[model samples]
Target: MTAAVRPPYRVGIVGCGAISRNHLEAFAALPEAVVVAVCDVDADRARSTAERWGIEHAYGSVEELLAAGVDVVSVCTPHPTHEAVVLASAAAGAHVLCEKPIATDLAAAERMVAACDAAGVRLGVLFQRRFWPAAQRLRAAVDDGTLGRPILGHASVLLHREPEYFSSAAWRGTWASDGGGVLMTQAIHYIDLLQWLMGEAVEVHGHIGTFRHAIEVEDSATAVLKFASGAMATLSASTAASPSLGISIRITGETGATAELSEFPEGTDGRVTIWARGGAIESEQVHPADVDPNVDLAAINGQLIPHHTAQVRDFVSALSANDGTGREPAITGSDATAALRILLAVYESSRTGSPVRLNQTATQEALA
Candidate 1:
C-alpha cells in the first residue's frame, strides 16, 4: 500500500488590516500555500483585499471564512480577539498561525492552546524576528555552549509611534484590547526572542507609564527578568522616543562570551557582534535593512516577507508529518503562552509595585 498524497494547503486570513498585507505577501511567495479566502469586519476591506491579492473568496466574518474551509488560517485580528478566532479555526480542523501577544490575558491564551490541542491541530505564532539570521546564529551559539552558561541578558525596544498611530485604531493603547502597551504590542518580538535565547523567566519586576501617548496603556515601560537558568535580564520598551532605536539585545555568559545584536527602524539593516573568550570579537552587518522610506509597502515587505515566509514554511513542514518525531514547530502555542506570561508579570508588577514570581508550571497564573 502507498501513502496518499496531500493537496496544496489552503490558507484563509482573518482581519484584512495593514499587517495582513505582510502575511499575504509571505504566503503568496510559498508554493505549498494558497490564499483562498480573506475575512474582515469591514466588508469593503475584505473585498478589496481579496481582489487585490486575487484570492478566490471574500467574507465579512471569520465564521463565513471558517465555514468555507481552509487547511490553515492566519489570525491577523487584534490582540484581544485572537482567542475567539483561534478557537473557531481549530474547531474547524484548521491549523492556526496567530500574530503576536497571543491573547490579551493568560486565561485566554491557555484556552486557545487547549482548544487547538483538543482539536489535534498545530498552532504557531507570528514572532518572525526569531527567524532573523543574526538571531538564529545567536541561538545556535547559546545551545552549543559557545556562549557558556548564560548569566546576563538585556533587550531594549525604542520606537516612535505618533499619537495618530494609536488614536487611529480604537483598539490600540488599551489594556482590554491591545494588551499592555509598548511591551505587549511593539517589543513583544524582542521579549519573545530574549526569553527564547536566555531562558524562562522565573521572576519579574517592572514599572510602566504613559509618558507620551495620551492613551490608557503605558507607552514607556521597563522590566527586569530573572530566568530559571539563573540569568538576570532587563527589558525596556517605549513608543515615546523621537527616533526609533529599533531593538537592541545583548547576552553575556559566565565564560565572558557575548552576543550583541541590534536592528534599526523600518527593518533596514542590523549589526551583530559575537565575542568568544580568547578570540577576537567579530562584528558584521546582517539582514539588509537598506530600504527606501517613501516606498512603505516595499520597505515593509522587503524585511518582513522573508522572515514571515520562513515561519510559514516551518509551519507547513510541521503539518507534513504525524509521526510526532522531529517535526515540532520552532514556535508553539505553549511558547507563545510563556512569553505572554512574562508580559503579564511586567504589567502586574507595574500595577502593584512589586515583583511577581512564576511558579514552576506550564500554565502559570499571570493575571494575579
Candidate 2:
C-alpha cells in the first residue's frame, strides 16, 4: 500500500455537551486538527460551549455546520438524533465520529452506514476505552494466542444515579433519546469490549428491572451472552448501585490463562487494570496507571490526537487515502446496528423469558 498524504485536519462538533468536551479536548491535542465549528439544537448550549472552546462559529443545525467547511464531525447528540446528524454529515461530504449506542435500532444504524458508504465518507464511532494501554496489551496477547482458546468472560459496572438524575433531563431514561437506559447508555462500553474481545454474541438472555431509579426504562440489567466461538459472557450493569462503582472485565481461556481489567476514578483513563494467571505473565502484575490514562487533550506527536483522536485520524486518513482499513478498525455506522441488535435481544429475552438469537429480526417492542 502506498503512504497517504498528511496534513492538518479541520474538524467540526455536533451536539456539544459533557461528553463533547472530551472530543474537543482530544481534537485540540492533535495539531492536525482544528475545531472550527459546532452545531446543536439548543442555541444557548451551543453558543456557550463554542465560546468556552474558542470555536469560531455555532450552527443551529447539522446543515449549517456542514456549510461551514468542516472536514469531519464529532457527534455527541442524544441517541435519537444520531441518524439525522450522521446522514447529514455524510451528505455534506464530511466524515463522522459518533457517540456510542449508534442508534435505537438496527435499521437506523444500517441507514446511517449506508448513507456514509454511498457518500464515500467514513463513519467512526467513539469507543475510546479501546485506546486504554493495558487493553491494548491484553488484546494483543489474545490475538497472538498467548491466552489460548478463549472460554468465557465477565463484565460488570457498579454505577449509580439518583432519582433526580432521571428527572434531570426529559430524554434521560426515555427509549427515544438515550436509547435503553443503563445497558445502551452506560454499559455499552463494557458491551463493546465483550464483543471486541470475545467476538459477536450469538445469543442473549437477560433479566432486567427498575430496582431503584424511577425512569421510563430499566435501571438494572444482567445478561448472558453466548458467542459464535463458543465463548460465554455475563454482563451485570446498574444505575442503582450505591456510591458509583467502576467497571471490571475478566476473560478466561481454555489454557488456564485469564485476564482481568477494571476502571477507577481519578485514574485508568487510557489504561486497563490487568490480572493474568497461568500464562506467560502469570507471575507478573501490572496497574492500569502503568500505561497512564490521558484525557487531558494531549497528542503523542502534537500532530495527532489521543483517545477518540484515533477515530478522527482514521476518518481523515480514510478520506484522503481511500484505505479500507482506515474505516474497518474504526466503528462504522452499521456496527452500531449490530450492538443495538444484541441489546434489543437481551431486552426481548428478559421480557419473554427465553434465549434470543442474534440472527433473529428485532421485534417492534425492540424500541420499547
Candidate 3:
C-alpha cells in the first residue's frame, strides 16, 4: 500500500480590505496554496473580491467560510478584531495567519496565543521584512558572533501622512483600533527587525504625542530601549515628515563590526552595508528592475509581493512538515508577540512617565 498524497493548502481570507489584496496576490503566486474562499462583512464586497480573484466561494461571515473547511485562515480584519477571529479559526481546526500587531490589547494577544496552543493549530504573523536578504544577513552576523558584544542600535521610520491619510480610514490613527500611531502602525516592521537583530527589550523609556495629526493617537514617538543582551537602542518614528525617508537602521558592536541599511523613496534602490574586522567592508544595492524609483504608497505592495510570497511559502512548508507531532511554524504566534510586548511596554512607559520593564519582576519601594 502507498501513502496518500496531500493536496495544496486551502486558504480563506476573512477581510476584503486593501491589505487583503496583497494577501490574495501572494497566494495566487504560490502553487502550494490556494485561495479557497473569501469572507467580508459586506456581501457585495466579498462577492466582488471573490469574482476579481477567481475564487470559488464568497461568504458574508467567517462562520460560513469556516464551515466550508479551509486549511488556513488569513485574518486581515481590523486590529481589534483579530482575537475573536483567531479563536474561532483555532476552534475550527484551521491554522491562522494574522496581520501585524496581533492584537490591540495585551490581554487579548495573550488569550489568542493560548487558544491557538490549546487547539493545536499553527499561527503565523505577517512581518514580511524579516525575509529580506539584507535583514537576514544582519541577523546572521549578530547570531554568529560576527557582531560581537552588541553595543548600540538606531532605527528610524519616517514618512509623510496627509490629512486625507487618516480621514480615509476609520481606524487609521486610533489607539483603540490601530493600537498606536507611528510606532504601532508604521514603524512596527522596523521595531520587530530591531528586536530580532539585537535581543529582547528588557527596559523601555519612551514618550508619545500627537504633534501634527489631528487624530487621537500620537503622530510622533521616541523611545530608548535596554535589551537583555546589554545592548542600548534609540528609536524614533514619525509621519509628519514631508517626504518619506523610508527605513534607516544601524547596529554597531564593540569589535568594529557594523551593519547599516537605508531605504528611501527617491533612491533607485535600497542599500545595505556590512563591515567587520580587518578593514573588510561589503555593500549591496537592491534595486529590482521591476520596481520604480518613485514608488507610491499604493504601489509599494508591488515591491513587497516577493517578501510576502516568501513568507506564505514558508508557512505552507511548515504545515506540510507537521505530521501531527506539533512542529512550530517558521514564525510562531509567540514569536509575533515578542515585538508587541515591547511596544506595549513603550506605551506603558509613556503613560506612567517612567521606565517600564518587561518579562521580569522588579522590586518596588514605597516613597517616603
Highest lDDT: which candidate? 1
Total backbone collisions for each predicted model:
2, 3, 0
**Residue-wise C-alpha lDDT for candidate 1, range 1-368, written one tens digit per residue:** 11111448889999998789888988888788899999999999999999999999999999999999798899999998899999999888888999988997889999999998888788899888888888888888888888876788988877777777887888998888787788888778888988899878889999988877898989998999988777889999898877666678889887788888887654643457545456777765532356322223345447687788889888877776644443557899889998989888898998899999976542334222
The regions of model 3 sitting more than 4 angstroms off are 1-6, 266-270, 274-277, 280-295, 324-326, 360-368
Spell out the clash pairs found in candidate 2: 9-32, 132-270, 270-293
Candidate 2 per-residue lDDT, tens place, 1-368, comes to 32233346568899876578778878786677789998888988989998998999998888888898887788988888888999988888877888888888778888998888888677778766777777777788688886665688998777756677677667789876777888988788778878888776788999888888778788899999887777889999987876555577888876678887766431345244455665455433333344432222122223223656666555555656554444353666655666777788888998899998888433434312
lDDT of 3 by residue, 1-368 (tens): 11111348889999998788879988888888899999998889999999998999999999999999898999998889899899999889888999887887778888998888788788888888888887887778777888766689998877777788788878788877787888887777788888888777778999988888898988888999887767889999888876566668889976768888666652222357445455877765533455443445566666677777778888777777776443566677786787888888788999999998787432232101
Candidate 1: segments with Cα more than 4 A from true spot: 1-5, 274-276, 283-302, 323-326, 361-368
Q: What is the lDDT for 192 in model 3?
A: 88
Question: TM-score for each prediction?
Answer: 0.91, 0.85, 0.90
Which 10 residues in a row give candidate 2 its minimum summed lDDT?
Answer: 295-304
Of the candidates shown, which would achieve the greatest TM-score relative to the real structure?
1
- Between candidates 2 and 3, which one is better according to TM-score? 3
Global Cα RMSD, each model: 4.2, 6.1, 4.5
lDDT of 2: 0.74
In candidate 1 the C-alpha lDDT for residue 129 amounts to: 85
